[model samples]
Target: MSGSLRSREREMGVVILDGSTVRAFVGDEEVFNRSVDERFAALDLNGDGVLSRAELRRALETFRLLETHFGVDVVTPPAEVAALYNSIFDQFDLDRSGTVDRDEFRSEMRRILLAIADGLGDFPLQIVLEDDDQGSNLLQQAVDLEAAKTKAAASGK
Candidate 1:
């Protein structure tokens, strides 16, 4: 959670990731939508059908990209962390409803994922992802999904 981006998670292995892997996942509309919905629901702890700031914070923690469960690093002051979370919530609350509906959630998620893909841009790097198969982490699912498709095609041939 501090210093390096690498954080430890039990029961995970290093996976090579690049822009193509991320793009492949986002490109699959069905998988992407379903996965987003699942994660969104998980964040919607109250099942209110919209994400509250607290809920959105949970989602960001899952992301651990924009900010850690804590702020970016241990050195970051509390005020900056609060502002950071506020900015993120504002970004997602496109209509400024003070809450994020599914559409807004999906739209913002797509933008973030695409930006990550652009940053990676074919540069493969080994990273660890949680094995939480509950759709919390979709990138790994994407990799698995693409592998399954490849396997199916090979067997069919």
Candidate 2:
């Protein structure tokens, strides 16, 4: 196999060492790629293809409030979460241009999730992933409700 492919397999292996099976990799890279695509879409608040530091930070802050607003607590301490966000953001901004494009964010986040699954990283993967799903669902519901309201208003016009 090629070096890169071998490396990917190795990384996947390490990520699975903790006994949690993440479905991001099934037979190939497509599943993980799709997840990344979905997450990037959701994270891109402005619907742009890039995520500015400010945009991501705002999202992080909102995520921090998940416990209070949505009753799903992923419990990363406030300061630690901020530091972790900054660290991840720095790593994702490879070009150091102060922004992370979709591709960059997806790749980095994929790696993060994998490491979390493997119990190899400092990030609280299990709690965050589980609670993040709930949080995202809540956010999506809110967005859908707002859209419906707007549609209703337009119809009444």
The prediction achieving the highest TM-score against the true structure is 1
**How big is the positional error of residue 29 in model 2, measured in Å on the Cα after superposition?**
1.5
- What C-alpha lDDT values do all the predictions have? 0.81, 0.55
TM-score of each: 0.82, 0.50
Query: Which digits, one per residue and each the tens of the lDDT, describe model 1 over residues 32-85?
Result: 999999888888999999999998887676655544453344456779778988
- What candidate 1 gets wrong by more than 4 Å, as runs, is 1-9, 62-73, 133-135
- Candidate 1 least-lDDT 10 residues: 65-74
Candidate 2: tens digits of C-alpha lDDT, residues 35-125: 5567667878888688987778776665444344334455566798778788867988988888898778766766665664465333423
